[model samples]
Target: MFVKYCTTLFAGIWLLFIADIAHAQQPLPDKIAANKAKDWQTYRQASIADSKMAVYFRALTSSELEAINSAKSNGQSKANSKLIEIKSELTVESSIAGFLLFLQDYDKIPNWLDNANGSQLIEQITPSHNIFRIQFSAIWPVSPREMLIESRYWQDRQGNVHIKVEDASDHYTSHKNHIAISIIKAHWLIEPLPNDKLYIQYRVIANANGKMPSWLANKVALRSSWRTLKNINQQLPNSDWQYQKLANILEYQELIQEPTSGTNEQTKDIMPSNNAELN
Candidate 1:
């Protein structure tokens, strides 16, 4: 009874923090404000105070919050198995082609992603769709985790790139020592912004699929996400991403047609829309 009470208390505090973060955004620009008022009522601003950029998270159900507090009791259920959703944005100085090129280098993924033990390309199902496996290292008492992910990427007519990442653990046999994560739905939105900057938005919903405590898993998820963004911001400029290229993408085709064409000038008036619409 005491353990349950403590869990409930901690969860209450966590939700309060979520509520605080949701309302902590600096003033939004007109377009973003309009989108927030219209399509993003369920999302709360989760970014740091006074920052122009904002991150958002959806409110979790009571069962979902319970699952996070104690995985053994609630996480095994089919309904409340998923982790909390995280949506974040990063503005970085990189061309669409360069960023795509950086992503295509699969082996280097662990360098930027926190807690990643190994990242490898399993098979190239298609030029844009491929299967990869990632190993995640956890602290003592929690078994290490592994995921087989199917990544599919494409570009829109508006010159924005979208990558969908999903769990594909059933494709291969599971390892003996690693806990296989069974659910993952993640997306990456790389939009071309004005002044040669790219507005990158990433959203992920996953489940640990193991006996690890939910609170610890949630903590790791949030911190790793923020760290990943920071790493991307720091590492993108260090490489010559502009000179790098992938021939399969539409942006690369457009570049072939007009080598001198600059950034997506039409997207200047465009702000990111609610990511829920992508589903």
Candidate 2:
């Protein structure tokens, strides 16, 4: 035959390209231990503002203060006082599965997420839940904006992890020339301190609904949540996202069974011992 059919069609395309690179390097089955376990509450012990950022208050239930004084006496909406909950705290050395795989990598989130020009991952509702989208880059005379969040992360039983973002923009479908961040509430606690530290806490609140002004949307959400939590704690001590190898993240399975005594420590810990003071 034609050279044995071209060597069996190049050995079946080289065994399907090594089985698609072993199914893209496997290891993504953690559905938060069958979900159900969120009741996260705690944000009333302020004092984190040596420029580290804070002002994430909560407490409004008299029918939400009579629907924000009946929408400020029917002027309609100020978008709930421009909803601006900002928060930040730190203590790094990262490893809660390398900062939750650098916050589940949504296309590497515009590299470091400062103004986040773009990001995507429309849906993956499992390996710890997902449904994302991000875009934002207009800062003068305010305009460009986007968000379709619906994140979810979990892991408790002492070894904390949280995550939890909202506002799914009615489950997808967006983008008609930006502008659509009606409201979004966010959170992301990591906590797992003691030696190989990691105690960061982040918070957010949004409402760039349209006529942006609540003191310029809380001064651009407090300098963009303090430079996006100081650029995710200075990019989590980049050792390629600090050894990104998540397998149900038990501290990366004990740092891959003690990688030579956690390799000389230091992943940028200490320096944000309570930082959120802007009420």
Best by lDDT: 1
Predictions in order: lDDT: 0.63, 0.58
Q: Write the per-residue lDDT of candidate 1 for residues 1-279, one digit (tens) a residue.
A: 999999998899777755543343332222222112323222323333222234554434555555544633322323242345667788777778788767767788888877787888889977677888888885555688887888777665456788878777766755679887755458899887666677889887676767765555655666666667767777876667776656544453453454344534432222234434565
In order of listing, the candidates' clash counts read: 1, 4
Work out the TM-score per prediction: 0.66, 0.28
Clashing pairs in 1: 22-45
Please report how far candidate 2 places residue 203 from its true position, in Å.
Answer: 7.1
- In model 2, what lDDT does residue 120 have? 84
Q: Tens digits of per-residue lDDT for model 2 on 4-35? A: 99999889876764454234222221222212
Angstrom error at residue 200, model 1: 0.7
CA RMSD of all predictions: 10.0, 19.1
Residue 70 of model 1, lDDT score: 60
